[model samples]
Target: MLKNSLNWIKKYKIHFIVWALFMLYETVVIGLLFNLYGNPIIYIAHYIVIVSIFYVHANFILAWALRDKTNVIWRLPFIIIIQIILYILLNYSADLILIGLNLIEVKGKHNLDSTFILRNLYRGIYFLGFSTGYYFLSNFLSQRKKTEELEKEKLEKVIQQQKTEQELIIAQNAFLKAQINPHFLFNTLDFIYHKVNMHSEIAGEAVIRLSQMMRYAIDSDEMENTIYLADEIEQVENLIYLYQIRKTNDLNVYFSYTEDVKHLQLIPLVLLTLVENIFKHGDISDDDDIAYINLSILNELLQIQTVNLINHHKVKNTTNSGLNNIHKRLCYAYGNEVSFQYQSIDQHFKANIEIPVKLLKLPI
Candidate 1:
């Protein structure tokens, strides 16, 4: 108990110092104004009670009343009235005790009458106003600090994004220069796939899926700013199928989509990147907790959402660069018209993306 008291005093030493100075100033001002040198015991007791009321009202009662809730209008005033009544009664009780013990002298019987009650009531309201102002000022400064922090973060992100974009441009140029001829690549894959099929059909099917995914990647570069959304969805389906083959169809994952969204055009590779992140960092083998991917158009906006249980073992070694890349591309292509949000909640990794259907002409 003694250790806790020492810690509390240490933490609030500044507050103690400020209050002591304020009390001294008030005492000196009263003495100079009316030459009324008050009883030390009475002054100490009164100041202690007022200080308690200040802290309790600001940090407890007012904080509770202002919390996000319903019917705050009636609740706040009701609580304030109750506190004022309690304060008046407490002051009256304290004075009666002091009078009984002869620790203080009452100059007149009026001190125990309505006049005294009214004075205490006014003091309670006065301190309550001070406490409320303190709470609002503290809250405003805290919010200002948070806003500044967020703006700083945004500035740092913009710098990092510019760097990433430069690196991406260099990487894309290198990839194009090093790429093998499309004709030679497809021919070789087809030939090998036929020979493999003669031996093992499953192995041949895997090669076919691989070839298709490669073709989509290469063709997306040759296409204009946008491709049919159906083409992207098909590649995603093929990728999932390839994973299913690898796991011998043991994986528990579902992909759903509406027919209308497939025909619409949008940036290529965004959905594919999201799905790849899932496969790289998600646990898809749990039968009781299946992963899900959904695609649809809502109110003229294309929506893509994915939810999966995180593979803790895999996530430890993984980075979210893939998700960040998707965000960069979408923001570049669609600007503020696009929305992409992802987070881990309740042990489940979830991502949601929405873009206006009209803004499908740009590329990333």
Candidate 2:
């Protein structure tokens, strides 16, 4: 009951304000009329009762008028006519009682005539005006509320769709990266087979290193995001060994740790991509033109620097797909915390990458 009352108040606050104004008008009329001739206390009491009756009448009329009962055309006219008759009858009965009690005088110098029919006509017009205004106002407010709800729902749907698309893109990129290691493995194995058939003694060592590299890749592939830095370094070392056996000249691989990394981790093969790029693009066949890779942690930063002798005389074709993939991975992993750059100078191709050491130290 209390909830319903509160809801009604909220829905009809303006109507209540109008009714309050009418009550105040009635009170003022009674006060002035009483001060002029009758006792003020009696006049106030009589008008209070009259205002209470008017309030109940107005409330009931409005309730029935607004209700979705039958056809509005039939219901509205019936409600208005019935309420007019009821109001006229009640007011006339009260007026008669007041006259009999001598609380109101309708004779000589002080008179209050019972004009029931004329009062009813005026009251009916008042109710008609109020009801018409209320109907349009309520409809406008309700439609505005509905439009706001629809806009909220549309925005929510758009946000959900964008979230789904972003997830799909992340999944697709992961799938593509997953394909890379296997393809690299197949090519390396083919090279190993050719070396063995040619009776190269280094083929045996290459097979051992390849086996370890394959084991690390397969093990790390099961992880969705990251692996320990120690494990990643181990895999890179094995790949470097394999690359050394395949290349005719010297290629140097160096790894250093300035900070404890038993707890450090990174996405698998992040550094390996840079290493692979070097082998693919840099000249490793000349002793004087050695390829060098250095990885270290210092000042809470993981630094990876690679300098390779660039054979400008040879055909230079480097696809950006691998770098783009790494860029995406770094963005997803470190956001703005990681920095990457590559430069080509007089005879050397260089890449320098710095990633926050805190990322590496996080427990995977």
Candidate 3:
């Protein structure tokens, strides 16, 4: 509460300073010049009422009256007349209370004469005019500050856009310098495959499978953020085949999926990552203990699950960053609608991912 009070005071420090200086001038300099010095209590009480009127008039009365520009001319004047009448009545009441309390001594009986009425009328209008001016000036300053802020934001956005464009241009140039033409690479691979087929058909097929996986990986960067689920599944198949050929068909793993999922779409590389993890960490060489990967659509969700026996003989040298990255990407793409989880059960490691597929973009 004290901190908030300090903040409020700091925010309105200029207003406080102006009111203080004005009160000092009225109580000291004017009193010295006119020789009309009186009770300190009277000065303090009247000044309090006057300052309250100033703020109430500017912040409330004028704010409401001018809120709608239409019909403001008559609305403002009528409210001000009512305010002045209240001010005059308050003045009389303040004087009566002061006299009853013996806070001030009265020299003569008070009368509502022309001079007295006119003097108070003039005083009320004088403060009203100052308050009105302050209201407009405050509004002008506030609008100017908002305009400056909007311009600053627009400039920042423009600068950021230009920086991004420059970085993209640099990246494109670097890629062009480093990239080998896809057509040439594929032609060379095909030539090698044909030559290898003359001696060993299995080796030639492996080369072709590797070439296809390479093409998928390279083409993936040029594609959109997501591809047809069928495409990724095909790549996963090729990946498994390559691993099986490497192990001379000794690896024991199964990939199962529904045909309905062929038309559905998903971000690439996720399924491949799961399967690669199995090969990297799981003991898939045991035919009696086969690893499992299942893909299906159930209750408007696409689910991918994998279960494999842990290879305790292999060195457990991994940071699990691939699974972490997959989780982050899935969450980014699907918000709370996607889930990825992995844990060890007994001697087997299991991982499962589910993503809501109701809004998937279908290919034409």
Candidate 4:
């Protein structure tokens, strides 16, 4: 406790010295006004008792009292009464010290008295007012400083938030560019495969087919809405060839397309998604199940059909999911000009799609 008090005094040493100097100046001014000089020690003792009482009540007692939530307004009476008691005690102690030190002339009979009580009471109000005003002003300035700091922090947070959002947009654009560059990447792969073809024909051929499929994906997603029908068919063919190499060699997968595709323009990836969905959901291992893919032109309308035995339930999940994506994209491109039919019968799933080229509306 003594250490804490010493630390506190050290922290406020400047305040204490300044206040003491102010009291001393007031004392000297009062001596000049009265045109009389008492021993400086007597005045020093006098103001010590008075200033200590009032400043203690103001700085320490009231600081604690006011921050309390309950009975705060009612604390005025209690605080005043405590200060009055302190004032009486401090004055009485000063008088005794004066007489003991022979600092003041003792002209009266030796009778301890409360004769100074009324005068001190009158002085208490002025001292209390000064202390109260100082306390309130200090509190207001402290609160203003805190409010300013809070506003500064909020402003910094806003600026940081904006910077973060800008970084996110840049990252998103970079990600889209990376996603849309597969065509360039696949072309590089094709170049590498051609250079290696002199060493290994089978490896070079497989690499080229994979390159074609990757290029198809990049072109379908990043280029114009409509692509040549031949491009889409070639992607389906590459995908099937890659699958045949990876899957069982004895797998019976049939693919047929009419010659009309050479002159037609079709929505990109329509044929590829259909063929991929078949491989993804079909029972290719069972020799008894049938799987077929066909594309034809009838009455100036391009038609595509796929049938596969459904073993997807045991290995992959493919219940109309691929169909949904195709349906949504085709509907957006061709609207009611597109016809789609899908069904499951006798452990087999079939999908048929037809679109009239004459009734299409192309995006600008």
Candidate 5:
């Protein structure tokens, strides 16, 4: 509170000084106009008393009266009562000072006039009215300045929020691009090592297919946002083939898709993640543990389904990671238009996803 008062004083100090000077000039003008310049004692005494009373009334007494305008019953009457008390006090004190100095005369050429009583009453009320006007003007300007500050602060917050979101998007894209490099290179190297030793020529074939899959992923990140239905299915086939040679143990994996898709475009890397999840978590050792993947274009709708026997005892479940990434990417790209549903029941886990693919341009 003290700091705020100091700040307000600093801000209005020049105005206060200028107004004081104007008051003194008005006093001098009134004296000259009345030809009362010869009575220095009377005029000078009035200058000190009037200036002191108006200053306190404007800054202190009026401030209290206006503090709660809602309580008119008490505050309004309080203002009137205080002004009455101050008027009586000022008159009584001025009389004592003038009489003590032998400046006032009751029965002589310098006797006080009855008209002077009316004039002093008029001056007191007149100064109070002016002081009230200045108080309201100061209040209006303070409110305007506060409102401008709040609006400017709100705008700055919104701009900062937008800037942070943009930066996060750029970082997410970079992180996703980095995700592909290590996994692809390691798989390619493993396949190449087996092929170079001549222990398995089939592994060399897997290496060629892995390179093709990587090319598709990298190209999709660079050149195009969507690819043909056939292109996606071909890459899924290569991913499955790579996994088949990857594990020493036998695996049960199956895929089915219609060949009648005349026009289909899809976001890349979606189907590959599902197949990777199956190999990582599905129970392939059991002859009955089959990982079934289905894809079809029916009436312009593209559907991908994966069903597998979940290895309940496995410590790590790779399906959650793959599905989470797919969900985030799908929502970012397709919003709510794409349908994706997945759940686990007992030992079996099922996922079905559908997207509108017939809207794409016809394949060349």
Candidate 6:
């Protein structure tokens, strides 16, 4: 009940302010009337009883009565009837107590007279008007508050989503940087080992190619997603050449292009990582177990298809970090514009990737 009262006060602050002013006016009127009659104690007692009755009506009966959802015509009459009944009882009690205390002489034989009924009926109408006004005011303010809260929540959600995207970009940049270090170390070791064994001068060319790859990676780090197709192709070619020199078994790679690729762009290192995964787990041997790769760009789309025979005797020891990283990069860059599929059937491993050229193109 105390909680309800506090809530009511907060909700009806304006109404309370107006009610306080009116109560002050009533107090002044009572003081003047009592001074004219020279009966201060009787007037004080009378006001105390009236105030107690008004509190009960405002806080309990009228507060909920005005909140009813019935039609206005029905609600008005119902509330008026209830207020009249309660006020009649209150006035009768006040009169009996005043008579018992000899505060006033009873000119009438009984309290239930026409004058008593008419006076209380007028008071009931006044109370109904106040309650109805406050009811509408409270409802309007409550709805406004709810609307403001909803708007604030929506704004907060949008801000949080943007923050999450920024964090994802940062994390992806870190992962890309981490990937570069290991790839560089692996390729460099292969080149050096091959040079020492075969006594070939190709190791000097490999060092220059590695330097160029490192420069590209460093320069591209500031960019968000896309990189030139020419740059990606160059990296893949260099890595393939390094593999060809290092492996003892027969490994073949074929490269063909239909047109100049100056207009095309793609996620940096995307194709290179796929080719790396192929070399990492694929079986490159004699006869039917050779690796094959085909890449083409036409009609504003990049198509990559790779096939290699899987060696069941070979144990798979690599983590999926490279594939997972590329997948995440694709989603961040092109969303659903890129499609990837992988399958192993009858000892042959096949992978296909298609990326929309429009997404990879530089903005005009």
Off by over 4 Å in 2: 1-201, 252-263, 313-315
For all candidates, what are the clash counts?
0, 1, 0, 0, 0, 0
For residues 1-364, what per-residue lDDT tens digits would candidate 6 score against the true structure? 9999999999979756876677667767866988545255665664554555555555565556556666555765676686668767776777777778787786656557789888867765665566555556666788999999999988876775454444334433543665757555445444443443243355445544554665576667866566667777788778887677667325755555445554477767877887887777777765656677777776767777888777556536656677778778877777887887777888888887787777667542
Q: Candidate 1 regions off by >4 Å?
A: 1-178, 361-364
Candidate 5 lDDT tens digits, 281-325: 777666776889998877667788999998877726343877899
List candidate 6 segments past 4 Å from native: 1-200, 260-262, 313-319
RMSD of each: 21.0, 22.9, 21.6, 19.1, 20.4, 20.6
Q: List the residue pairs that clash in candidate 3.
A: none
Q: Positional deviation of 228 in candidate 1, in angstroms?
A: 0.8
The residue pairs in collision within model 5 are none
Clashing pairs in 6: none
Candidate 4 per-residue lDDT, tens place, 30-66, comes to 7899976778787778677767866787678788777
Give, for candidate 3, the lowest lDDT window spanning 10 residues: 166-175
- TM-score for each of the candidates: 0.50, 0.42, 0.52, 0.47, 0.44, 0.42
In model 2, the worst 10-residue window by lDDT is: 163-172
Model 3 misplaced regions, further than 4 Å? 180-229, 232-364
Question: Candidate 4 at residue 209, lDDT?
Answer: 75
Q: What is the lDDT, from 0 to 100, of the residue 7 in candidate 3?
A: 100
